[model samples]
Every structure is written in C-alpha cells, then in structure tokens.
Target: MNKENLFDTEDILSEGGVRDLFEEVEVGEGEKIVKQGDAGTDLFIVDSGQCVVIDDKGAGRIIDSLDRGDVFGEMAFLGGELRSATVRSNTPCKLLKLSREPFVRFLRKQAVPGTKFLIFLERFMVERLRKADSLRVLISGDQDLSGKRGLQQLRADIRARNTKPLLSADDPILSEICHWIYARNDQVLFREGERTTDLFIIRKGEVVVVDEGAGGFLLGTFGANDAVGEKCFLDGKPRSDTAKVRGNAEILMFTRDTLVELLERDSSMAIGLSLGLGSLLARRLSMANRTLRLLTYEELREKAEVSRLLSEMRKSLRIKTLH
Candidate 1:
C-alpha cells in the first residue's frame, strides 16, 4: 500500500495536529510496534510502510496497509484498555508515533465544549473498538461467513450472559413511556441545550454521542447497545451534548412525564434507573478525564480559549487542586 494513498497528507497534518506530537521511527521488516496485552500509551500513524495485525490465534492478517495518513492503536489510548492485537511492520518502514498525552491534548483543543467533548471522546473510543472487532473478523476470513448457525450461537451467548440489565426487558412501566423515537443514519437525536424530554435506551443499532464542535475537532462516535439522554431527564437540565444515529437505530424512550408517573407508582424502577444513570455518568466522566489528561498543552490551550466557560472551569479545577 502506498503511504500517501492511505492518508491525505496535507489534510491530516492540518487537522490531526500531529506534526509536533509525532516522532519518526524506523523499523525493520517484522518489527513489532505494539504487543498484545501491553498497556497502550501511544498511537501510530503510518508514514512510509505497511503493517500486519496479529491475533492470539497466531494468525497474521493485513487488516489495513498504510503508507501514510492512517492511524492505529487508538482503542487502547482512548479506553485505557490493553492492546488487543500486535502490530508489526510488514517491511522496512518509517512511522510517526504520537504519545497519548499529546494526542489527547489535541482532541481537547478541538473547538468542542467540555461536556460534549467528553461524550465525543467516549464515542470515538467505542468506534475504534468496533473497528478492531471488524478487522479481527475480516482477517480471520470470516467476513463472508455470517451464517445462521453463528448468529444463533451469538444469540445463545447473549442469553446466557450474566450481565446486569440497565433496564429490565419485561418492566411493565416501559409500556407507558411515550416520546418513543427511531433514528436513521445522520438523524439528529438531540442537541446540546435542547429541553430535557425523555430517557432513551438502545433497543438496536448504534447512536453516536457528539459534542457541539465550535470550530475545532470531531470528538468521536458511539454505537449500539448504549443509552443516552438520561442525564437531562434525571436532572431536568438541558441536554449537554448531541446524540445522532450512527446507522439505522431504534431507541426505547420514556418521556419526562412518564418517568414521573413511574416514580410516583413503581418507585423501584426510578431507583434502578437512577443507579444505572449514575454508573453511566461515572464511566463518561472517567473517560473524559483520561482524554483531558492525555491531551497536549497546546490542545488544552486551544480548548480553553474556545469557550469562556471551559476556560473558567479549567482554571477553577486547577486552582482547587492546588489549594
């Protein structure tokens, strides 16, 4: 693969803010840049060579071949997760390595508000994970093997899973919830500052959480099986960010009045929802903090300057910590 063909050099260099964060590294053929299970602290962009991704099955597959302008190793950096695959140079190559801190800073500096910024970061992280999963399936030559048997097995696995439910499928109160909505690709689910109207659950497909980008950077994308709009519903506050469909999606929704009626009747459902909301909020906050910490100083300055509220918030946090 031609490096130049893989990435738009001028566009990525301009928008990715990678020029300063990247350092040139030369690798011999078969040299490994990332090892599975290692703690990931940096992401790489191919500058002049192709790389192969190796899975635990000892299968070496070319998921993506890069010459330049392509990025990898993003999932671990965004999610604080361990490297899920090993990336090795396929030939003598020149690569650009961007440390996590600087990349996070770069994302932060993008003209997005802090809260929405965090939501975007979460979506971005999830998108990378999905990409990696897709690559795994492709490399295993299973891309065309979507068999009914496999799907049935997957369904069985899901049924057998012991994970706690965010909301019970059979909850009677669900029937009374109004304001139900279905979203199609690129449809706006809601935007920052929209009145709190309903709580949503991912019945199917994916919804991306994005921030209102003032003029800076795209925060990220999120997908199916995720619930959003709970914060606004719970707090009676305006929406903090934007939610949009990643693809065709179905959302189970409960209007504010329905929630109130539920609370007035089956208080336990409200309590469970509150607990679930807290868990989701905590996870979002942690991801945001990780992203903020990973950002470079320049990125921080850019974000701080974009919004006065963000600037003051950053200043207050810094001061509070100092005292």
Candidate 2:
C-alpha cells in the first residue's frame, strides 16, 4: 500500500504575497532551508520552486514536500520548539519568510488583509494538524494496541501542551457576544464528522477531545481558557474530533457569523481576535507535529525489535545436522 503523506495541507492560498508581510529569500538546490533540532521560529512559504521535509533522526527519511504557496517551518514558528524536520531545497528557489515578531507588527499596521491572512493560516494549520493526527491513529492501528489507551501523548502534561489560552480574563468576546453554556459531566459538546460552526472556549472546567473510532483514544484534554473547537469556528469543514465535558463546565460559544459581524462593526478588535486565533492554532499544530515525531520514532524501534527477534528465531529453528 502507498504510504499516505500525513501532512495534507489546505490548498487555499496562492497569493503574490500576504500584503507584503514576508521577505523573499533565495536558496539553491540541495540547500538545507531548515534543520531538525535547530532553534528557529521563522515560517517560510514556497514562493517558487520545491523543497523536501526530512526527519533527521537516525538514518533520516523524507516526511513530505512543498511547492509554491505551501508552508514549512511552522512547527517551530508556532510551537516555540526546535525545528522538527529538515527542509532542503529541491531546486533553486525563492521563499517568502516571516517570523512572529514582524507578523504581529504587520497585523497591527494593516488589519484588513492581515486579518484575512491570519484567518487563512489558522484554518490551514487546523487542516494540517487533523491530517497528522489521522495518520498517527492509522499507524497505531498497524499493531494491535487494543489495551494501549494511547500513544506517547498520554504521558504529556495536558496543562503544559503546545496549546495556549486563546483569550485572557478581560476579553470582550466573554462579555458581549458569547453564548454561555453550562454543561454536565460527560456531555458531548460535538462529535467527529458533524457539521457545526460553533467555536467554544472553556470558561471553567475541563474539555477532552477523543477519537471514538480507536475505542476512545484520547486526543487531548483541554483546561480552562483553552479552545476546544476553534477550527470549526473558521473552516466550515466537519469537526475532526469529538469534544466532551469532563466535569460540570462553563463554555463560551461564538458563531462565525456573529464574529464576522462584530469584526465588521468594530475593526479595532480585529487584529487582537484574529491574531489570537492564529497563535492558538499555530501552537496546536506544533504540538501535533511533536506528537507525530514521537510516534514515528517509537514505531521505528518496535519494527527493528521485531525484525531482530524474527532473525534469531529463524536461526534457532535450523536443523542440528546442518551444524
């Protein structure tokens, strides 16, 4: 069977530039654009030519590739982690590069196009993350992990994940437009593949995302101030994971239409809200990448161990007369 590239990107962007917020950098063929474990938090867009994403662990392997308009280096750009993969230029290329510091300043200076760009990035990142998680589950299915509740993600501290609170205590969305929800424990907020456009922020209590297909594989557990389904809020795609209440919880819901209306009425708040969504999605995507890397390494080791044992067993089964 063909190996599916888990990093499926949303092909919604092909602009000359995102309001000229990015700087163009030239690269030559076979040049390593970004290296794994490097301390770089800058994102790059394939302006022209191609590049390959390589997992620089052990013997190393190619994870994916990028062409015009595709994004790379975002795992570190959003997650504040070291570069997770090495990107090498396949051809002499021109890349549009932007870091968080300048991206924020551009958003403030030109809110309209900047907001649109931020919204696009947030949605794109969500799609990218969904593909990564989808592949993770598929890989786990290869081995009978029936009793294994989850992959290495379970050991990670939920409160200290790459996801950050989308808003603070004084955000206006909490006051004017949010639909307050008081949910009971074990209540399902939303299910995977459901068509819903509601975005939820946990006001008090915990929310957990689960993959019911894997016999309740825990995707993530989010605490107060974290967003449960921010992706559904922007992209009209079906929900990727089911969100359930862990306890009696208070959730603030916002409809995309309502947010659009509010942004139209008061453009001043656009930069803050839109950028916040971008940052939140960036961190979530970063976490997903890290999880993917961990899962990949574990799977590799498991396969190597099985091969070694099989070889030993074969040797032991040889006829004594042969010796």
Query: What lDDT does the true structure give each of the candidates?
Result: 0.51, 0.65
Across 36-124, the per-residue lDDT of candidate 2 in tens digits comes to 88888787878789888777884677756777766676656654657767889989999878787887675566555556556665655
Top candidate by lDDT: 2
Give lDDT tens digits, candidate 1, residues 156-268.
Answer: 33333314556674666676654556778988878877985566777677676654643212334444445777655544457656787777887777665554465556656
Query: Hey, what RMSD does candidate 2 come out at?
Result: 11.9
lDDT score, candidate 1: 0.51
Give the range where candidate 1 is weakest over 10 consecutive residues by summed lDDT: 314-323
Best-matching candidate per TM-score = 2
lDDT score, residue 246, model 1? 76
TM-scores, one per candidate = 0.42, 0.75
lDDT of 1 at 102: 61
